[model samples]
Target: MTYCVGLSVDQGLIFMSDSRTNAGVDNISVVSKMKVWEVPGERFLCLLSAGNLATTQATISLLDERGLAPAERNPSILTQPSMFQTAKLVGETVKEVISYTTPAGQSADAMFSGSFILGGQIKGGKPRIFLIYPQGNFIEAGADNPFFQIGEHKYGRPIIIRTYDPKMSLEECAKLLLVSFDSTIRSNLSVGLPIDMQFYEADSLKAGYKRRFDKNDPYYQTISEGWSDALKSAFDALPPFER
Candidate 1:
């Protein structure tokens, strides 16, 4: 299992994903679930994946290969004219992977199913974020729903839902994501650390700050401990019910 999140804020977009996968309790491994593509002043795109490992890796590998080949030879995300088209391309690619990997006599939605959170901006368009399903369909982040999460998301969603503010700065958004991720890691053994995070400033058409937070990172340690203490204090401060 894994945990990945993408946020659409006024200033730009933020993406975070844990780097943990497991076949069993004893077969755990670390593998990045985030893929980034940038074209300097032209475009910037990030993909956060979750679900079957082979399915997600194959989908990302296909995108990477097409991105490096001639546009006439294959469909490449870099060739898309808008973020919406880019998302459609990703959705189609994901569906194609699911089909190609499904064994004979098995459904396409078998154990190899996967999902992705796509976010970025194209030269002539505003920034956007999308959640693409294995069925080749997707939905965009909007005013009412300015964020999306894939994988072991339930453990971390409450914090985001309760505190997310569209006007928050990109830095604040990053901090918020760390808290969300920290919450998730504590609750789900399948979602381990060495998180990969990326930010994209609106209209910049370039990638912003990127970082990795391992178990020993000082700031991450501080946030993890601080959040726990804060939560405990908040809980203790609540008035008790009358008997």
Candidate 2:
């Protein structure tokens, strides 16, 4: 399992995903779940994936190899003009991967199947965010749901629901993401350390402010520890529900 989150604010998009994959408690491994692509001034795309590791990696490789169209048989993400089209292409790719792995004619509704959050901007267009499903379809972020999360989402969602504001500064957005991920790390054993965070300022044309945070990173330590203490204090101050 993994935890990945993406925030869409007026300023732009912030995405992060942990690098943990495990078959069992004894067979844990690290693999990045974030995929980034850029065409400088032309376009920039970021993908956060959560599901079967094999399926996610296969879909990413397929995206890189054939982008928007996969050899005429599969749709491509690159050739799509809008982020919306690109998402469909990704969803198609995901569905194809699932088809390849499952028994012929069986429904691809495997419990640990597929899901992805796709966000990016085209040269002449405003930024957009899409949540692509296993069925090769998607839904964009709306005003009420300015964020999309996959994998170990529950542990961190409340923090986002309480603090997310469309008008917040990018700095605050970043801090909130840290707090969100920290919440997940504390509660889940499947979602482990070494996180990748990517921030894109709207209309920048190129991706900027990408960072990797692992166990030894000092600032990451500060953010994680500090947020924990803050949450504890806030809890202490809350009125009791039980008499």
Candidate 3:
């Protein structure tokens, strides 16, 4: 299991993902779930994946290989004309990977299935984010729904839904996401971190800020401890229920 989130605001987009994977309680390991692709000032994109690691890695590798090849030599994420088309290419790639791994006439929805959150901007287009399903369909984030989460999402969703503001600064959004991931980390053993994060400023058409926070990172510790205290205080402040 894992937890990854992508948020879109007026200024730009923010992404966060936990790095723990487990075959069982005794066989846990850590690996990055964030993939980034950029062409300096031309375009910028980031992907956060959750589910079968093999499936996600293959999809990313295919995109990355194509993006690095000579221009127009073959279809690649870099060759797509718009963010929407880029998303379609990613979806198709994901579906293809799933199909190749699953036997014919058998359900492809086995343990090998996975999902992705793709966010960024292509030159000459506004920034956007999409949640791509294993079936190759996707939905974009917008004013009404400006965020997407895949993996162990429920534990971190309430805080985002309650406090998210379209006007919040990228800095503020990053802080909020830390707290959200903190909530999930405390609640789920499978979601342990070293959290990875990325930020993209709208229309910049270039890679943005990036960072990683391990368990001992000062700022992350502060947010985790502060949130616990805040929750306790809130619970104490509420009036007692009576029959």
Task: Return model 2's CA RMSD, one decimal.
Answer: 3.6
- For model 1, how does the per-residue alpha-carbon lDDT over 29-56 read when each residue is reduced to its tens digit? 9999999999999999999999999888
Give the alpha carbon lDDT tens digit for every residue of 1-243 in model 2. Answer: 899888889989888899998877798999999999888888889999988887888899898875445455332555678887788789988999987788655454445487999999988788888888887888899799999999889999998999999998777887888878888988898998899999889999689799998999887889998986887899999998986
- TM per model? 0.93, 0.89, 0.92
Cα RMSD (Å) per model? 2.5, 3.6, 2.7
Clashes, model 2: 6
lDDT of each: 0.91, 0.86, 0.91
Error of 3 at 53 (Å): 0.6
Over 4 Å off, model 2: 66-76, 104-112, 239-243
Preferred candidate (TM-score higher): 1 or 3: 1
Off by over 4 Å in 3: 66-75, 104-110, 239-243
Task: Encode model 3's per-residue lDDT on 1-243: one tens digit a residue.
Answer: 999999999999999999998887898999999998888877898989998988898998888775455664443787798989999999999999988988755564448888999999988889999999999999999888999999999999999999999999999999999999999998999998999999999989888899999988999999999988998999999999999
Q: What are the clashing pairs of model 3?
A: none
Better of 1 and 2 by lDDT: 1
Total clashes for model 1: 0
